[model samples]
Target: MEEMIKLNSDISVFLYDVLTKRQEKNAKYSLRAFARDLGISPGRVSELLHGRRLPGRDLILRIADALKLSPLETEGLFRLVHRQKLVQKENGGARQLLADEYAMVADLECYGLLMLMETEGFKSDIEWIARRLNVTALRVQSILERLERLNLIRSRYGVYERLQHRVTSTHDTPSDVLKESHANVMKHAMEALYNVDLNLRDITSITIPADPDKLSQAKEEIRLFRRKMAKIMGSGKTREVYNLNIQLVPITK
Candidate 1:
């Protein structure tokens, strides 16, 4: 119904956001240029990015191919869109976990399959998932065992499943807090590293007016900066910032 379509729209927007971020990081072409290259209107591309339209399967595949996204990424996007549609049709009572949550579950090997099983009321057990994933029963058992150990999942009647109590409470947490937390973590980590690099370069710069004494002072400052940077990088807890982009750069003097 209409709600289903709206859910589809929301899911489409989420996919668009992921793809757009990837494109922004990797693509050199402007959005208009890229749209032209893909034989679509710029406005249409904008609509897709803004989640005003639900892209068809064919278009989704085409866009994935055009963006050079990996099969995993493409499948993830498709799954999100499909789940959104299902949730919308089901009265929108379920909470929608963001990509980070998906990533976390993926790390535990309990993302896609767990969500599907939960939604479909299937018993999350080795046998059930072994058949679904077309994997060996032993492998599925190992995964379920690990999940149970982490307390992320539990077992009932030999069926393994995510703990219902641990589900993301998106309804209780304000969206702004979630967004701000993510942004702050990503920003601070990036800025910290960037500042370190800049300071190193400043220390290395040898201008005509730079006296020997000033150069020595700069070297000491650089040493302090390097130590501070090392400390920041070594802090395991502080590195929890969600940064997907590679910031490695070759400095040219």
Candidate 2:
């Protein structure tokens, strides 16, 4: 009956809120029902609520889905539960590095899953998403779950919405996740070059020879162009999903 608690950084506290909300909606909703939804045992759910055990990454994601949390709330749940997992590993006298490795590895996802949610005529239907993204329906279903678990999208009354936009991956400190994002986009671009109509896709390139010292200025110019194009793109109604790649590659490197 109270305002939903704003999540910051505590899994036990979050679970408590979930339990309370479930009971409020149905006075008969018991811990066993919560466990059934989470795919965990009732005793285990109680342990989580009581802070006697830390939730595994898989379990935490299941919990998020069971709670039907909004995207932002799901992200907070992930960050908090991940922190708790690390603390749990450390408290067991195990090296914290292992848990930290798990945390880092778990942070990545293929970009397509989230990007497709932004396309025109976006729907929560698995088959629609599969056709739009040119992926298998089964893969689309997996992607939907991944996006929901990562809190990148939310499903409310069977309608899905993207909560965040514009992903930036720094070349300064490369990551496997970042590399994978670029790889997925590049593959799609390659497909467009061969399969898409000339008018439907724009593929262009330029060659410039200049002093290496001006690389910073060149980067700034590219940034400005990207923003300008984004502004132009936003002026019209979005009819379809599009990918824009501004690649600056060295011919001599």
Candidate 3:
């Protein structure tokens, strides 16, 4: 069983995967039950699973002991958790500022180009990137230069390499830039609705009454959901690049 199990870099994903498998064997098992087994509060477990909190060394050890992870898996979890701490630190400081600044003028195409570099069969050729993004070769070349200047991408031995695994524009992103970025993505979402096959795209919405005061919590949940999907979709052999746009807006006054 240990040999068959694979570990995910995201601790939340790893924990959830174990819970899910256990649930498969015992249908009545639930998060609360799992929390009891792990010797933590249900609320605490929920927060960890939802990405609202990061586990510390003690908590990691408790989880490892409860889950009976192999030594290799336990060490892998420690590494991943430490890496996550570093990322969180970066996101709260200078790296996040650089990312936000890049987003302000980078445009949608620039973001797309960055992700494209991660896909399988990716080539460093300007024309190839331009064709993939439906932009001019000049546009792709210019974006490459801008990214290189930012040290977000670098050319080594004739190969372009991506430096950042993620880029997000959060609270500090200029209002105008944030608006324009959303507008650009919304336009593409509209286009995909008509031109792209349903199998390739998921464009849907739900209309429900929601309290204004709780919006902050809702937005955080959406952010967590996006991160979870990013990890899941990015697993295995990534062959193509895709956009994930989730919008929750108020239609009623």
Best by TM-score: 3
Worst 10 residues of 3 by lDDT: 92-101
In model 1, the runs with Cα more than 4 Å from the true position are 1-29, 90-253
What local lDDT does model 1 show for residue 174?
56
Q: Model-by-model lDDT, in order?
A: 0.51, 0.62, 0.75
- lDDT order, best first, reads 3, 2, 1
Compared with the true structure, model 1 gives a TM-score of 0.30
Model 2, C-alpha of 11: deviation from truth (Å): 14
TM-score-based ranking: 3, 2, 1
lDDT of 3 by residue, 1-253 (tens): 2432343435555666677778889989988899999999999997676455779999998988898888887777788777667766757421233345556344778888888888999999988888899999998888888876554566755899774455554455567777787898899999989999999888888889889999999999998898799899999999878889888888976
Clashing residue pairs in candidate 2 (N, C-alpha, C atoms within 3 angstroms): none
- Residue 212 lDDT in model 3? 95
Clashing pairs in 1: 124-160
TM-score of model number 3: 0.62
* TM-scores for all predictions: 0.30, 0.56, 0.62
Residue 145's lDDT within candidate 1 is 66
Q: What is the C-alpha local distance difference test score of candidate 1?
A: 0.51
| Each model's total of backbone clashes | 1, 0, 0
